[model samples]
Each structure stands twice: as structure tokens, then as C-alpha cells.
Target: MKLSTKELTESLRELILKGEFTSGEHMREIALAERFQVSRTPIRVALAANAKDGLLKYSRNRGYSVRSFDKRDIIDAFEMRSMLEGVASRVAAEQGMRLDAEQQARRACDVNDSLLLQNCEIDEASIEIWREQNQLFHSAILNQSGNRFMHEMMRIVQQIPAVYPPIIAPYRLQDLRLYNAQHRKILDCIIKRQGMRAEALMREHITGAGDIFCEAKPN
Candidate 1:
């Protein structure tokens, strides 16, 4: 099979998100090119693109390495996300004109319900599913805000190293359950047109997740 540079970039980005490639690890161009069965040109292009996306650090002479975010970076990222998202919620509410937003929010809630109903413990794959749905729900609300700056800021924040689901070896079912429950509550608030409540819930939800991520340190 063949892979495009964009596909290769996405594959490497996912590897970083899943913690397959740890921070400070150098990405050997030849090795990656050979492994992906592509030429070095695409590999270089992919690395450059990922670097621009803030997923990797590139130096003219030193090549590319995975960028690491410390605890403070994670906290700051969440803080910014919460503030922007809260504003987005308020804006959406004030406008009072978002049929598509309401639908997307409801669908996101339904997706979470399906996942939670499985009643299984949190695993890598399950966490990925939750992350995808959560992102969709948040994005839907932001899109409704009609603020291009807010959306662009969130797009950048989502690329941060610690923004994805934490890679805890012993997955915590309780944390997953609690987070999912919060998602349901937030959706309810949005559906009921309780804009302020929705904003507060989202802020707490993001900050709470940040706290949990910090506490669940790598083993």
C-alpha cells in the first residue's frame, strides 16, 4: 500500500497523541521514510508540516523531535480553552439562533450515551472514541458562536501535546464515567437554553479534566 504525505503526517500525529513517541525523541527521516515505504521528500514535508502545527520541533541542523508540554503548559492550554469555550456558549445563547448547533449537541450526547451504555472499563480505543465525540460537541458549540477568532484559537489549542486524552497505563474507569456524566449534564443545560449554566459546566469540565490529567502522572 502507498501513503500520501498528509496521511503520513496524520499517522505520526496520532502516534504522538497516543504516546507511542515520547517527548524529545528524534524522528529519523530515513527510518520513517523506510517504515512508511515512501521517499524521504514526503517524510521531510510531513515533518515540516507537523512542526508548523506545533506537534514537533524542527531545527535547521538538528532535525525534528517531538515537542513536549510540561504540566504548566497543559494547565494553561485548558484554561485558555475553557475561557474561549465559555464565551462561545454565551454568544451562542445570546444569538438564540442555532438549529444546527442544537442538533449537533444532541447528537453528541447520544453518541456518549451509546459509549457509556457499553459499561466497560476505559481503554485506549474507548478513550479515543470519547475524545472524538467530545471534540465534535465542543466544536459544534463554537461554530454556533459565529466567531472566527474563537474557532481558530480552539483549532490551535486542540493541537497541543496534552490536549488529547491522557495516556495513563492503568486506565481509570471512574474518571471516564465521571467525565461522560458531565458531558450529559452539559448537553442538558444547552438543550434547556440555560446558557449560563452551560458555560459554567463547560469551564468546570475542562478544568477538571486538566486537573485529572496532571494528577495521573506517567509511570
Candidate 2:
């Protein structure tokens, strides 16, 4: 079926992240169209968007190829992500969070608390569940930051590279208890309106998990 530009973009991005294409593999429009069961039009649009996301390289003559990320690249991504997310947390606290945003984030935390209370295991399905719930929590903070630029930068961070977050495809997975504890600490600080503490906790949480992810990745 023919997909819209946004649909094709998400489909192709997930495919790439799932390792369907090797690093530097040329994403020929015709080939991708065939693979995705679409046409060249959507493929072209999606590829362009992926290129802008830094997940693909585009050149005048060569078309698009998947960009390979190195250890340093991953490190840099987490560094930037931590700083950005920390800033978001701080902004949300200092500016006074919107009521709805606060409610949504609390809901996300509640979901996590329920899961952990049930003694969830580290399985594939559990990973997917955490990813979805955790994003809701983080997205709420980003939205409440009340800064359009920060929201845009966050998108860039998630899209620019394969983000193997703490509960996701971490290179070396962290203990869920520790990870969840950090999450709780962040939420606590935010709820308490401790702006700087929230910021520091967020930065520490991201960077600490990143260290595990990177150390497990091949050099």
C-alpha cells in the first residue's frame, strides 16, 4: 500500500534502526520503494527527511546512504541528550508546569510504578512496554518546558542516531531497579519544584546509563 510521507518516514526509520540495512548501504529510492511496497515518491520524501535527521547521508550524485555511528558518536549523542533533557526538566520546574502536562507525566510515572510493582522481567515485550511508557514521561517534561527550541532539539537527538536508551536496546542493559529509582528521583525533584536538582538528576540518569550502553558497544 502507498504510505504518506510521515508514515513512510517512520516505517523506514524503524527499519533502519532494526538493522535492515548495513552501515553505508545506499538506500536507492527504487529499491526502498520495492522493499516497503510503496512508490518512489514517498520513498524520496522519507529519505530526504531521514537525511535531515542525520540517519542518512545525502549527496548531489550519490543519493542516500545510512550513516554509521561510532562510539564517540554515541557518547556525544547522550551528552547532548542529557543536557537537553536536563534543561527541559529545569525549565519545567522553574516556569511552573502546566496542569495537564503535570498530570500526564504523573500518569506515566504511575504506569511505571505499577509495572515495577508487578516485578516485571527484562524481556523483549517488557522492553517495548517500558519504552512507550518512558517516552510519555519524558515527552511530558519536554512539552512542559515551554520552550519550542528545546522541543525541536529533543526531536533531533532522538532522530539523529539510533538511541538505545536505558530500557531500550542498551549496549549493556542497566538494572531496571536502579534505572527506575533514578526515574523516581527525577520525578520527585520535579514535583517538589526543585529546578536545579531535577536538572542534575536528569543529567546524571542519562549519562550514567549511557556509560553502560557505550561500554558494551564494540569499538
Candidate 3:
């Protein structure tokens, strides 16, 4: 079976997210083509797309290398994300109307809430669910902001290391629980149409994660 460009790209993205490829590791088109058993064309397309997404950086003669993000970069990225996302929330609230996008955001929040209600035990699987729902909730608001530039900016910011799947691979159950709770709080604020509160909560939510990740020295 042949892999589509999207499939190849997503596979490579997961590998990158899982730290299968270390920071600054050079990627060769021919090597990836052989590894994925695909032609160089699709490999090239995947690489180019990922590069534009901020997962990889390109140089004139250096081909492509996984971008390395440090503590400072993560902190800075979250700072910007908070402001942009806050603006989105405010815009949604000021509009005084709940559109399909707002409902989608609520749905994502509900998913997270349901997962937390499980209360049995948290594990890698639970963490994956939380990450997906968390992103969906945030993306919902950003999309509703009706600001293409801000939405695109957040997408690029999210591609940074440590933004998705939050903690390091070997995360503790307690930490995961705590993170989920924080997400719930942010969602609560948004659902109540407390725009200012939601914005503040979101800023704290993102920056707090950055702080914890920095403290733990995940990278």
C-alpha cells in the first residue's frame, strides 16, 4: 500500500513528537524515503510541509534538521500564545453569540471533563486523550476569533516542543491528573462566557505548564 503525503507527514510528526528524532538531527530526503518505503517526492513534500509548520528548520546546504527548543523558547512561545488566545476568547465573548465553533469548543471541553470523571487511574492513554481534547478546545476558540493570522500563528506556536503531550514521555500519573484539572478550570471559565476570566485562566494555564516543564528540565 502506498502512503499518502498526509500519512507520511503525520507519521514523521509523531516520531518527532515522541522524540524519536533528537533536536538538531539532520534529516536526509533519500534516507527518509528508504525508511518509509516511499518515493522521494512524497518525502520531500512531507519535509517541506513540516518545515513550514515549524517542526523542522531548513538551511541552504544543510537540508532539514529538527528544530531544537530550549526553556526560553518555550516560555516565550507560551507568552505569545496566551495573549493571542486570550484575544480570541475576548472576541468570541464580545460577539455575544454562540456559534457552531463555540459549541465545538464546549464539546471538546466536555470530553476532557468526562475523562477526568473516570477517576480510576491515569496513564499514557489518558494523557493522550487529554492532549487531544485540550488542543481541540483551544483551537475552537482561536478559529472562532475569526482572525486568520492569529489562528495560523497559534498553529505554528503549538508545533513547538513541549506544547503537545505537555510533560516528558515518562510522566507521572499525579502530574497528569493535575494538568487535566487545570484544563477543566479553563474550560469552565469559557463555558460561563467569562471572557476576561477565561483569558486569564488560559494565560496562567499555558505559562504554568511552561514553568513546570522548565523546572523539570524535560529537554
Candidate 4:
């Protein structure tokens, strides 16, 4: 019920990313304050911060509303993410991934493989597990990269709904398996200290999701 300013801001951000608030939906201070059980002052601060973070758009008279992103916006965000994640993968390979990080990535891939074997078609529950493992694999590499700037930039870019790992996981078995196989190749390249190959694979891996999402966009 009680949340610090940072917590409040992140909470609101998570709601936006999860599509709990639709694009172009307006947020009211009074309603949000009541919902979060916080004072209006903190709600105002949180709203302003989110607006600054590009999650909300502020108008002269209309206050703050969820920012509407067109297909181009999503595509551009994904492009940026692809570049940043590629760099992370390359750096992780050059630095030589830590033993613990390697273990984490390998375990994540193993779990994903098992999940795929168990489900011909991924259900909602299985999708959640898949997302968790996907995040684990990616994050392990990013953390091993040891680049704080890239990490911060990734946090910003991935705030876009479709660019987040959870949103990028495809429900279809064929597509999901394709992504998982790429993960294996990327990790193998990184472990072998092939920085260029790791970087290229990582870029393609992220870009593949972008292409799928853009193609699915309504005309």
C-alpha cells in the first residue's frame, strides 16, 4: 500500500509495460492515488516522472495519458534494443563469461528445451515460464558484459511494450523453437569467445522478434 517514490514510479511503469493501461488512456491523479493508497502529491510526482521517462504524454490542459506508439516507434525501439543487446553479447564474450553466468544461461536454455518438449502449443502458463527463462538467459549475458551504460540504456529501451522479453516470446511452437535454437547458438559463440559471431547472432535474434511484431501490426 505504501510505496516510496521510486517504487511508485516503477509500479506505474510496470502497469504501462504490461498494457494494463491502454495506449492513449488518460490517468487521473485522484483515481491513481486512491488505487495505490497513496497521497495525490506522490501520484503527481510519479506521473511526472513517468512522463519524463516517455511512458506517459503530458498535454497543456489534459494532464498525462499513456503514450501511443505507432508501428514505426516500436520498430525503432526494437532496432535500438538489438544494437545494445548485441554489444552486450559481444562484450560478454570478449570478457569471457563468468562461470556462474554461464551456468545460469545454460540452465535457462535447458529449462526452455524441456518446456518446449512438454508443450506442443504453449499455453498461457507455459508462456510465463518461457518468459522467465528467456529473461534469465538474456540478463545473464548482460550482467556479464559489465557495461553499466548499456544496462541503463537497455532498461529504457525495453520499457516499450513489444520490446520487453516477456512480450517478445512467441506462442507458436515453431517460432518459439526457432528463438530457443538461436539462443543456443548465441550462447555457444559467447562461450567460445567468438565476439563477432555472438554479436551478430544476438542482433539477429532480437531483430527477428521485431520483424514478427511489425508484420503482425494492423494495416
**Winning model by lDDT:** 4
- The 10-residue segment of model 1 with minimum total lDDT is 161-170
Question: Which pairs of residues have clashing backbones in candidate 4?
Answer: none
- Cα lDDT, all candidates: 0.76, 0.78, 0.74, 0.86
What is the alpha-carbon lDDT of model 1 when measured against the actual structure?
A: 0.76
lDDT of 1 at 31: 90
> Across residues 1-219, which tens digit of lDDT does each residue of candidate 2 receive?
567789889888887775677788888888877887987888889999888887889978998998877788888888999999999999888887788987887787777667766754566676666667878888988888768888778777765345332325553233555776787788778878999999999999889877877887777
lDDT of 1 by residue, 1-219 (tens): 898778998887777777767788899999998888999999999889888878889878889998887767777887898888887776666667378777877787788678867857766677778778877788888888888887778866766635234454433667666777887787677767788988898899888876777666452
Tell me the lDDT of model 2 at 150. Answer: 84
State residue 204's C-alpha deviation in candidate 1, in Å.
0.9
The TM-scores of all predictions, comma-separated, are: 0.84, 0.86, 0.80, 0.91
Top-down TM-score ranking: 4, 2, 1, 3
State which candidate has the highest TM-score. 4
Task: Give stretches of model 2 more than 4 Å off.
Answer: 59-62, 117-120, 160-174
How accurate locally is residue 212 in candidate 2, as Cα lDDT from 0 to 100? 78
* lDDT of each residue in 74-99, candidate 4, tens digit only: 78888999999999999999999999
| Candidate 3 backbone clash number | 0
